[model samples]
Target: MSEDWTRLSAAIRTARKARGWTQHQLAEKAGIGFSTVQRLEGGAPFTRRPPSLDRIERALGWQLGSADAVLAGGDPEPTGSVDAAAPREAGDIGAPPAKRLPRRIEHELASGEVLDTEVLQLGNSRVRMIIVATFEPGDGDDQEAVAEDLEAWTRVQHQLRNMTPSEGNP
Candidate 1:
């Protein structure tokens, strides 16, 4: 088991170096902590639960079972899921396929109060809208409640986005 771990560690180090990625860069790309990457690459023993193999594979642009193969001292194989030949920045590895943007729309009512609406957009589609705040004189609505509701709604939208298929036909 130790030998397998050692081989896996070496393979990880080699793949990271081949891509000109530092430990910190790998951590960021893999969505893992810097110390996790350090510990793995440092061969700190397989005594504890390791980082997610899926995350490491995604970060290194390797096939799904590549980690297992490397651990068994075999060659890594391409999954052909992502274009390995294409140049990718560290920021692009674990980033969401769609970009998110929050847009604020405010209007001054006839009563001199401002009605503020915030819309969260994922890529070109608007995913969520919240009445962020009502800036009115003598208004005492709990702003914290509004924030909490918005947060919960945002989480739901994110989950929906993940569950939905990216390809329209598929």
Candidate 2:
């Protein structure tokens, strides 16, 4: 099906302006090149990647696939019902502020175990994550076993990040 690049471009521009962000700022937040965002906003013909579009959509606080929907002549759905026209506060950039980065984040596994991780932003478009600790429910932990499990889990996350869209996700 043909896509309306014009519509997608306008929608992206509107969202970026609504957030009081320049093309460079959006590019940084989306982890994409400045030219990509500029070309997209200018309605210039260019090859599109799913990951790039997904990042741009996420950076704009739009739901995943919002860009594709807009290109198809439909409205982009806002993530968490955010109003694009809402006024932005001073220094309230679209991306999370550096000081607001989580020092620690915990996730509970379906098996009732807990995984602790720390996520660090190394620089633009580069992030490092460390598994701090893992807790098994109601049992003494083995240090060796915990290390192995964390290593295996990290490898899986790496695989997922590198997988193409057609591969889908487990």
Candidate 3:
């Protein structure tokens, strides 16, 4: 079953344009890089990261699996909107639960740089963390440092998961 990249791209592009959004705007709303939106709109290829596609689907107000349906020569299904203030619970029929905002923290370093972190709990025992570093003006190349810092945290998390009770660490 080959996927129709052209069909998917056209659907996404048409939806985005109908919303009067630029590629950059869609990328920001989808929490992805701008080039990703370009690639998708250009029918370059499907993303290796499946979560990126999921994010794009949600950002475009499409129901889950709408992208796959589109690639399979079907139209995207629009998601029914749920009020953020509406009282809802898990397993509710019809509409999904309202989205929750992420917890954010910001710290200013002595060098006048700022680090912002957002923590979102997807479900029980599953959390996603995003870190953004804002260097002072004229500091053009600190993203690698931020990525290294995030990698270090990932390593620490794995190490902690591997610890046993006999190690005398909780």
Candidate 4:
């Protein structure tokens, strides 16, 4: 393995152990396979590369960083400790974003789950669906729903390619 891979491999192993997950558990949670986790730890080869990072981040809820932060009272905190919601168990968040969720989300946003949705027709003849997602500061694990939505969108796009806009079959 390359030096970067070696170091990252060790770090992933450490984080997984720190979270008290067996490789199989982590794999299942990340929506990946057991062999992927083993190869990642061994650094045998980063065959899946970038997507692997997404899976790992999804399984761990948060990824370690190297930034430094200062608390309100002037205490310098270590980097990689961006724990916005400190939950009791590892990855026990109510719901988390997808492993491949777009990180460049704009607009000041918050995380939530859909409790209700209502469709409204606007004055400008545009219709919008207002979904109410119940939320608190997230514990940040469990990306299954987001993953499912993403997969659904992908299928929608594929279906769209076979249709013409004039066909009323939308």
lDDT of 2 by residue, 1-170 (tens): 77888889999999889888888777777656778788889886556533467667767888867887898889998887433343334344334312222212322333355565555443343445444445565467678777778788788667645644343321
- In model 4, residue pairs whose N, Cα or C atoms come closer than 3 Å (at least 3 residues apart or on different chains), thus clashing, are 113-133
Comparison by lDDT, 2 against 3, better one: 2
Error of 1 at 83 (Å): 8.6
Q: Could you give candidate 1's per-residue lDDT for residues 20-122 as a string of tens digits?
A: 8788777776766678788788765675445355667766777766877777678777655532334346656445322322111222334345444455445
Q: Score candidate 1 by lDDT.
A: 0.62
Runs of candidate 3 with Cα error greater than 4 angstroms are 47-49, 82-170
Better of 1 and 2 by TM-score: 2
Candidate 3: the clashing residue pairs are: none
Candidate 1 — worst ten consecutive residues by lDDT sum? 97-106
Give all candidate RMSDs, comma-separated: 16.8, 10.5, 17.9, 15.7
Ranking by TM-score: 3, 2, 1, 4
Q: Give the best candidate by lDDT.
A: 2
Count of steric clashes across candidates, in order? 0, 0, 0, 1
In candidate 1, which residue ranges exceed 4 Å CA deviation?
1-3, 48-51, 80-170
RMSD after Cα superposition, model 3: 17.9
| Every model's TM-score | 0.45, 0.47, 0.49, 0.39
Model 3 Cα lDDT, one tens digit per residue, 1-170: 77888898999899888877888767766666778789888886664424466667777888867888988889998886412232223333223222522212222344446544334443343444444444454446577776776686677656655544454332
* Candidate 2, residue 74: lDDT: 98
